[model samples]
Target chain A: MEHRIESGADALYMDERDHVATALRDMKAGETVQYRNAEGLRAVTVVDDIPFGHKVAVVAVEEGADVRKYGEVIGRAVVSITVGQHVHVHNIEGIRGRGDLGSKEAAAQ
Target chain B: MMNGTFMGYQRANGDIGIRNHLLIIPTVICSNQVCNRIMQMVPGGVAIPHQHGCSQIGADKDRTFDVLAGTGKNPNVGAVIIISLGCEVVDPAALAEEIRKTGKPVEFFDIQSVGGSVKAISHGAELAKRMMADLEKQEKVPVPWNKLKVGVKCGGSDATSGLSSNPALGAAADSLIAEGGSIVIGETTEIIGAEHLLAERCVTPEVSNQLYHIVNRFEDEVQRMGADMRGGNPSPGNIAGGLSTIEEKSLGCISKCGKAPIQGVIEYAENIPDHGLYFMDSPGNDIECVSGMAAGGAHIVCFTTGRGTPTGAAVIPVIKITGNKMTFRNMEDNMDVDVSDMLDGTGSLEQAGDRIWQEIKEVAEGKWTKAEVLGHQEFSINRIGPSL
Candidate 1:
């Protein structure tokens, strides 16, 4: 069972068909986990869920862009998220962008 | 006329229908049981039981009245047998008179006038059977694809729906427009953070302003209730299913209407006129949304979802499609098409669109959708005011 993230998609998608979900739950840094779609061997997906789909939260405030899943922004890290740390509402917040924010046109109406 | 060419009754008001049946229309709640009893004796009859038609004032009452009239005027119905419990604000005879203008036959009886439910049912059954017998005699004609008006709807959406089924359905909606057909997309509340995207697509500034205004009206109502949309619509299951924000949900929601230049915006459940794309202001509740479209004159609805809901309408046929592979696997009984290939890369968006378009054509030609086959005829009119 292989699932690969599609190209042009914004999410750092993790396809979990071949590997165990627990591996993503327990694995630490320096472990090279692979992610594959039908495109056949694109790139390795780091086993992480919360903050970034990359390595777990490591630093105090991450500087990288927030990773998107399901085509919507989930959370943000002021600095880089290192491997194996709980990423919750405290670390990340809703996305702020043009057309990405709550509608203002109707708010006044 | 060519034999076996997708037959539906040719209504007197110059419309064609894929289904030919006499409907039992109840004017008030007091007459629902009597309507049901009449349906027991007639096989090809439908009963629409609603809690409206009394104590409703102003726009609230008018909205209910219009929907009932639209249901009666729907081309699918060959005739209507109205069952009214006397002493209601809604005049059954007046409703029957409005339906008669469509040239479809109508008959009405009041339970109070007939002395009770039993007598009314007996009288209604006779009228219904006679109407059905006449309806059974109406023949189908080869309707031009241009006469086809479809509603594009999405509900129980998750993140994947925008990426898969919704976009794929958008493709199909574009195809329908290309063939000179019309499509209407509704769910005003669901449009939340993305009404501007849709407003930009409107063909005119007035239409765009209408879109903006509908969203505003909905927001005002929410504030009046001392609640925000974030508290409802995008349920907890949607969050767990991979949705992050209502804005995220809305971006996905709008995809069901392909990239056609929107011709106009319409009120909730208002009749769709002419060809091309339209926006209907409505809440995201699936049943009420579907009802709005049906009452607005859509012959069928293309409903896409990732959360796998089993809902259909009493009058319109709902074609269900799914994008989540797990949902497809688990809810095969409810789902009609699978676009999981968008995720797995087995199929292209065009392929999925073509498949759905073919299904729409076949459904228009008398093929029963899974919803209809499974008897999922759900109906709920959006009540704008408190149920006083």
Candidate 2:
């Protein structure tokens, strides 16, 4: 959002949660660009690029703040995220999804 | 803008509507046939044959209740006559109460109350005639553009949809929003992977979260069905039209909402209270989805399609826009706006937006949408249940 580098015919889309994402890069184009994700301010570089319109784990989640991508709860970050970093299931985990038949039962317990 | 007009009925609830319709609402499936027969006897009434109203429980039951209430409350309806079987799980009185709150005259007759079908049909027609007569005396005031709440939707999508028709409609949506009008967008399942793009534009964190929740809810439901959404969410039709994945399909689907601040999310059939850009949690089922938006109070719907559709709401004017040259050419009779020039590179997005905006004014002023002129009174409310 700060600066636009060159995507080279590649389009970038924010995930459901607006963390730092590589959500939708052109898959077949091999055409890619880089951006500052929890790393350098005004950063522009390609790190974990994928196909056209593929998902990329986001970085830069703050404490207790939900990650935004794919317009849904992909996961919640356990710790803080810096700009220009990669966020995956490793740091972000389920908060609204069913790993246990939902936590309303756990809440009751 | 547009200086067009259509024959519409004015309602006491302070709503301007394009249709003066007597709707026969069946409280239960057992009464659907009776309702249909009543519609057959009446010249200007409409009937919805639904699978709900009985044999549903829990959220399924609640969904049916919402839809029933929503349908009866659509502003296009001048009057409503509920056809009931007397003892259904969803109460006809409660449904009638919801509709009556809109200040329209409503009458209900149970087939059991009249000893069967023939008597119910006879009674329903008579009530419809009286209601229609009362509605005829109403008049239309020059309602502002802001008073219009139109639903934005796309179906039978193609790649050109994202590049042309969808963005054009989105521009029109932005124009409408700028004019203080309301725009509602649905098809939650179609927006699976693209929810974040919309979330970033949310007016508030709460609205952002609602956008997140629906996408998550849809993903969970698809998972529960044990079939990958990648299978059907994009549909073979969509794939043939060039959308590659559910994510890709969704990326294009969200464009219809335009660049407006997200206000909030509403339940599938919940009333669209003073709309800005409202997202309704609904499936991509064309008939049911359009039905849901209609019931929720969209006076009109601007549906963009790349593959083409003949679907129309029973009451509201459904204006169809397409960017596919072949589809537009082949299905010329069904389409309202052929924005294929955008694909041909002969038309710019702003030009298409102006044209559609002009069409909107014309439609609002009472120009019959192609669907209306073709008598495409297609009506289907999402039936969230199994048959007994």
- Candidate 1 residue B313 Cα shift, in angstroms, is 0.9
- Candidate 2 lDDT, B1-388, residue by residue in tens: 4232234555678776766678888988899888888788777788887877877787888788788778778887888888889888888888889899989888887999898888887888788778767776777655556667889999888666765688889988998888777899998887766778888988899989988988877767655664545437567777555454555567767777789888888989888867489998888888889999988988899999888889888778899999777788999899989876764446777788778888987887778898988878776767556655
- Most accurate candidate by TM-score: 1
**Can you tell me the CAPRI class of model 1?**
incorrect
lDDT of 1 by residue, B299-355 (tens): 899999888889987777899998788788998888888887776567778888878
Considering summed lDDT, which 10 consecutive residues are worst modelled in model 2 chain B? B1-10
The regions of model 2 sitting more than 4 angstroms off are A1-109, B1-9, B383-388
lDDT value, residue A108 of candidate 2: 19
TM-score: model 2 vs. ground truth: 0.77
Candidate 1: chain B TM-score against the reference chain B: 0.96
